[model samples]
Target: MSIEQRIHAHYAGLSPQERRAADLILDHIDDLALYSSAELAEMSGVSRATLSRLYRHLGFGSFTELRETARTLRQQGVPLGPDGDPELSQHLDQELRNLRKVLDPAGDDRTARAVSDLAGARTVLVVGLRNSHPVALHLKQQLQQAREGVRLAPLPGQTLGEELVDVGPGDVVVLLGFRRRPSGFERLVSFCAQTGARTLLIADGTARRHASSVDLWIECPLGSVGPFDSYAAAMSLVAVLADGVLAAAGEDGRRRVSRTAEVYAELDELDLR
Candidate 1:
């Protein structure tokens, strides 16, 4: 049974003090991962004995077992309410884990395949709506220099239908799908799929349930590291994938990039000062 089920099953029978400790745990479960048993007891206004009893009631062999479970759940993308000034070390550790997950050997192989698909496409459209628009724009900017037919979807003041009119075979679409995805986002992907465009979705684990909407689903570690979901992992994936795409583009890509650089230099668009 899940930890929650165990807690609920034995909740009513817990002593009043034990119930108080239980309530404290449920209210701030995320904090438990970083708190010692004695610290948690003090913060919850309960004695160490009360915490021990609560853990026993919840069927945990020891307080350490409960804490370890909390850590595992959080790492698995479980919601832990709003982050509250976590230690800098913890944040760094989490980000390191996130990066490792994305850049591992298996992930590298998948990214290589994605790069191959993108490099062979006639046109690539990047779609980022709401909070994802900036990332999409960044991708488009980077890709435009490397390849000729990169476009950002839903151009300024235009609807998707108008933008996708020319979308068909030999096209690739990269989509950013973070939490609280915009309404109709799934339908938009479905429409792209029907038009024979290969759609790659960059999102969190939550996107697994909606797998059929896109041809490729790259899970980026996303969570509320602070007030918003940290995109460090997603951005790192983008950077690496961008490199992969450029590598696949080879000599032709280099030539296009050289031309773009010449144009930028002529216009003096860069600031070296």
Candidate 2:
């Protein structure tokens, strides 16, 4: 595992002081090579002793060792947050690369497989929390129009376990796992697998480490030119996936769309002004 993976894996077990120190390291990863243990400890509001212990807890002998590892990661262009002044042009370049990566042949193949699974499944469950909610909701709406039994994870104050109790063969679960995810993400994936549901993850590269858990993952780069991570790639992926689902659904999709239109017309939901 990489340093980032190690940190993420052990994050939940970290002490309060260790977590604060870890956040500082993750936020300023590019500069980790520059700061001394004392300086880092001061920045994180912890003692130097605590800082030393933090490295050991993360499986390093010393802070210097950890810094050296971080330096190597920086050299490899592992995203280490914003390093300098952000420019619109730089941001646009990164977003363009992200979009291209998603449309590449390998990415297209993965997307096609996900769409095929969804198109043939008896139930499609779209899930996302926090910033991912919009994408999940949008996917559910599109899939509802394309097929039957498509819905977002229900929200009647039910635990995930309760909601998934009936999920078995022929069910598809799509999870949107962007940065700053909820605590129960891995649990959700694991539970779905245990219930015999095929799982697909649309997420940032942060999820690459969890690849073995899901049937397929569409990684949308979240690099940014500003304070916030960009979502242009993710949005593009959503559109492509929806298109793939429609194509795979074929005549069944057309019939579902017609049914949906009939219901909308009967309910007077459309204002054709």
**Candidate 2 C-alpha error for residue 226, in Å:** 0.7
Q: Using Cα atoms with residue i matched to residue i, what is each candidate's TM-score against the true structure?
A: 0.71, 0.68
TM-score: model 2 vs. ground truth:
0.68
Each model's lDDT comes to: 0.80, 0.80
lDDT of 2: 0.80
Residue-wise lDDT of candidate 1 within 7-40, one digit each (tens)?
7899999999988888888777655676789888
Candidate with the greatest TM-score versus the true structure: 1
lDDT: worst 10-residue window of model 1: 74-83
Tens-digit lDDT string for candidate 2 (4-39): 777898899889999999999887776577788888
